[model samples]
Target chain A: MINLPWPSGLLAQAAPAEVDYIANSWLGIASYLIAAALFILSLKWLSHPRTARRGVRAGEIGMTIAVIGTLLIYRAVSYKWIFIGMVVGSLIGAPMAVWMPMTAVPQRTALSHAFGALAAALVGTAHYYTLYGDAAIDRFTMAILAVEVLLGSLTFTGSLVAFGKLQELVPSSIKGLPNQNAINFSILGAALVVGIWLTASPMQHWLFPILIILGLAFGLCLVIPIGGADMPTVISLLNSYAGLSASLMGFVLDNYLLIIAGALDGSSGLILSIVMCKAMNRSFTNVLFGRMEPSAGGTSDDIYAGKVKSATPEDVAMLLEGAQRVIFVPGYGLAVAQAQHTVRELATELERNGCTIEYAIHPVAGRMPGHMNVLLAEADVPYDQLKEMDEINPTFAQCDVAIVIGANDVVNPLARTDPNSPIAGMPILNVDQARNVVVIKRSLSPGFAGIPNPLFAADNCLMLFGDGKKALIELVAAMKEG
Target chain B: MHNLEPKLFTFLLATFLGLEVIRRVSPLLHTPLMSLTNAISAISVVAAIQVMSEGHTTFNHVLCTLGVIAAMTNIIGGFWITDRMLKMFRREKPRRD
Candidate 1:
């Protein structure tokens, strides 16, 4: 068990009266301050791509220093067990970092939140156990501990459910026990009661396990009803939960750095969640309780029986020769086909053909907020050419052509034309306003919202049926030959 | 209990400061921002280390060990994964030839 005397040996010899104690304590404080400074800088640098790599470096160094500082505090104690834990963690973390695909970043993030929250909860649980009934443990610390455990436990399971939905381990459709919302709320209520009771009566330790169980159940229930289409928001929300849990764990531990860092994480996550919801024209309550997309409507057979106007790559290239301005709108289909690089190459080729090319990015265009931007950025697309929805929506009409590349709902005119549409009221890229529109997709299928797009029927629209990357490559070749 | 005031003050300050920082981030960087923030929240590693180092009994040791493992996984995995993603999001394109 790696047993070592706590109050004896080095601890007794290095007691507060000794010079070593003062030196060690001062060193610890200095390390913490430096680490905190690095973390703040990292967050600031993370706001832009140019400095983001340096930001990651700063965070890594700060975390390393924090780990070292903690190890120094308990230097007198045997670290056999701690080292073992560190080894096990690295074993899992390294593969996940190296082997995970870029498309699965959202799910990876969810899993990270799950682990982080579970750590905070476990720490609070351990602290309460170690100091059980100790008169020195005050009510405020207990209350914070209760908060830490509650958030940690909920985020732990909530993030797991989110990960499952994103990975399609469990069906992404809404599945919940009867009276799911009511049951979830009652469980949360019960946990809060137990937490308060524990705060008031430290001796009544029997309530601790019950509180943990309820919180975990609440987390599972919270994310189970959310479908995969809303994974981005749910993942962000779970991140906020994990952050708040860490912040409260800081209070219980009297660690200011943890408090600040956790608060930063929590607040930013909440803001991102709100932004995602707003982009979808939905509220937090609706996102949490409402079904993602109603499945009541099927694609109308009459609309696409023979109405889809298919075009060849050569035809699109010929059309591009006359076009002076073109805007490319991308969505999840682009991501699915991994066509970002090919698309960028096509844009470059079009630019060379004496045409203006710009990207129109909807906030919720891909699976996550800014998913298309990341994919485009990876292909080294000029940042200036990448335009947000509001910035490009008005400019579409001035363009000669709008290239809708593997995108559906974002360019669907039904959002504005049909009030009863599932995606109604959601802001969309105005590709329909352009003089001519070209869509590169495999088929005239319904998008994530399960609604058929009427933009396909517009007289000015042309559908180029094929894989996104393959179609774009062919178009690029056609342009080169001409 | 008496230390509540300072803790609450720090909490409020952190909250406002965090929101202000988030407001400045462009929509283009939201996914990276989410991942980066996920990495930073691994600050619980500080508490996890302390817990493992301080626990006296076998039960305390085992429980704290689990916490340490989880916290380390979060810190290491979160930071490394974010770095890998950001590295791929450069502004320079690869050689065409």
Candidate 2:
């Protein structure tokens, strides 16, 4: 809006001077303030499940108000393209919401960030060009604009890579030429240097395009080396970047509500990223700089070297017969194998046999934080049955059977005993402490941490070698037969 | 930098408020929280609309149109996905087929 070159002659013919003044008057400020308050209340309400729906509703209302307020104050001369855009957007958005499986939610989130950041980048680019004609380049404004575009451009491509990784369009592991980390850092460093130079000299017209290219390339590089295991942190970090860019865009436009709202978004995303890093027991640097360190204590070779006990579905069903309490631990493998429904069915059959069932969710389990919760919730698992790491750890000791469905490092006892292991100090569900442990997996393979799990070799642990979904179906059938 | 005092103040205040508010959200809602934030950040759609409606040149129109399309997708998709996710969080047992 700030960048659109308004023709002075046409503006005089469109509306009287008095009408223009009232449009920007106290009414507009009051509406924006109210919208801001609603946004704050919406976030507060979302904090608890009891009021989450209401919170979502509040946010919707706030967005509607913000859109409407902008319309009232800045009356557009034409509405043709706006209507077309809204219609097309709804057409795409509605079906996507109705049809996308919950398993694809992480990819959906990354795509959303990509779109949002693209918008910000376009706005920043438009602003630079429009203001350049007037030569209204000032040091402070130039610096802010540089940051806005830099963050926006990087987030746009960075989020796309994240989407590709989550959707598996690209390999989830480090791809491309070797020395990939070095190349990525160099792109980032070059972007920063170009961005700084542009900030100092806004009129260096040729430099702007270079800055944009560098930024987009840097985003691609920044995310390419990161594997899917660190997806939560990457997604959260990208969200923070998008939010900060929007906030800086607010400054360039001098819109107070945009500033407040964008900053709120930026900070929340930053906090989430930090929390996600801590949950994995890794610092931001380690996650970014260290390609996942292979666990020192165990490897796939070591897994086969140790004695691993294998069991059949019938054996697991028989073990469950007299079990009073069963704990289900899920990991990324369960998601990859699309086994949530089958696992739920197995739990239900077990419950009918007078067994109690609960889910033990590691804080960093699955690809994203709370990913397992979404999977289970989609399969209609009761909310009460899913317990957080702290809430469920103690219960594992009393658990008659802990069925680890395709989980690995999170249950690795090396975290507790081996100080040299990559995942040392990270809290794991004490599934190994259960009287009996059954792990359903295809083979003796390392997980995201690239670690061999000692839990598989434990005295009570029985490995059921098969795909998660097929194995769960077999277990359910055996349970029904028994 | 000194001239940006008001904007900086707003930024700091909002950052503090955001940290406080987000901490209260249960981990179960982290996904929804993220989607909601993505939607709000697309508030720049307001700016995009202004640009399109006030079109001066064909080039400007094209740029703004792209902005409108991208931001609208984010806003619409973000909200719809969030609502769907929140619906799944109901405490009542989902009806089994």
Candidate 3:
């Protein structure tokens, strides 16, 4: 029996002898290219609700290819660990994707970002441990590794906190305690100083873990002061952090592919954050330190406690009868009620009754950018029939009936009349302009922005209080009966 | 060219393709996403500085400088643009109302 060297034995058993590097590499490259194409296609498809499912599928396929490519190149001593990790990840991730309510999407996204950050941090730490004593590892490599570990760990912890806030595990809106920002800045400053010192003095390896701890503290300080309303931006920012960490790890590993992918992810995340900020008409600085006064007012119970003029589904259906045109304004309420499909069904019925139906989307209607559009599209609402704020605001006056589904601040008349209102200047859908307005809500509650809506008090506006989906379904039934 | 380098190149190309898909499928526009992505591109700045400071060739130094500048544009300019756009949303009351 021929005795093989231990290194050879490891390599031989790790990969099949029949495997062709040329073919495998080509295949890997091809798979990666295909994945990239799919990702792009998915993004394009996602822009419209009609094609979003296809886009999601495309993205999934691309990710699969990426995973396959990584697996192909990876030479692991033990296969069990990798398989176990994959299984565990899928088990945890699949159910969460399916079971999580649409209302908790922002929290889900934040958690996903935390997972990404943790993965990057783990990779950096593992890489550092593996190559610690190698003479080939230079000061630059060590510095990059330190930076990656620090940023990744911070992103992981910070994202978890953001997730907690979004999930309401902690209070969603907390004002910074006196000197909170100061303390946060000081902690961050100290962490940066320690990080610089550790990198400068390679001899003091003990300082590395200390730097990581400081980074974790900095991340906590960074996210804790941010309000819940700004969670989308925070999630995007954390995503960027995770990407930067991945890029830094790429540098440490001298992997060009990782560098490119990381850079792309980081840039995209940053852009998304900016877009979200723009949608809310807030600067990044404002989001970070601006303590946006919680939309000043009483809670939902206080606002809805008054005599709300409730309309039954039959009444709403009768009101819709003989209406020349109907416009539907959807808000986060619609999303929370998961009433998109029902709204689409209602719209079809209304259209069949010789009433022109259109959807009015406010710029900042839901929690995140494009929230309303995404929900509407999910229900297979036609893109052309959906009108942006600028377009539908004019049309609202011509509509015979305006149906508001779970929308509040965006349709409130106070934005135009009340100077003291927090959301005064922000553009809103002019649902109040319609001849008759019917608001479908669970209660006469304030929206996420926490301001009283005068639209509810308007003489023409009739409040239809109930679950948006159930109300819409009943309305559809009533319309059929009429 | 080495076989490994070509494979690496292909991998990069594939990643770009994936990004394009994400850009398309996303409800947001690619231009904005790309611009925002520039912020993450700042990692290139650190990478460039570290690589150049390591006393590499003049070509490497030039490359690093370019990378740093591009990354800075993405970070600073991107943030500035976002700030300006958001400022427009500041609530101003209608005088007559």
Best by TM-score: 2
Q: What is the DockQ of each candidate?
A: 0.58, 0.56, 0.06
Candidate 1 off by > 4 Å: A1-19, A133-137, A175-178, A292-307, A477-482, B92-97
Better of 2 and 3 by lDDT: 2
- Candidate 3 chain A worst ten-residue window by lDDT: A1-10
* Candidate 3 lDDT by residue in tens digits, A365-455: 6655555654565566656676767777887889999999888867877667766667666667888889999999887656766677777
Candidate 2 share of real interface contacts: 0.59
Residue pairs with colliding backbones in model 2 are none
Candidate 1 whole-model C-alpha lDDT, 0 to 1: 0.81
**Candidate 3 local lDDT, residue A314:** 90
- In order, candidate lDDTs are 0.81, 0.81, 0.62
| Candidate 2 wrong stretches, greater than 4 Å | A1-20, A175-178, A296-306, B1-3, B50-55, B92-97
**Rank ordering of all candidates by lDDT, starting from the highest:** 2, 1, 3
lDDT of 1 by residue, B1-97 (tens): 3356777898889888889988788787888788778778877867876766556778777877788788778777888877877776655454465
Off by over 4 Å in 3: A1-78, A98-103, A135-137, A294-315, A378-384, A413-421, A442-445, A466-482, B1-97
TM-score (chain B) for candidate 2 is 0.82
TM-score of 2: 0.93
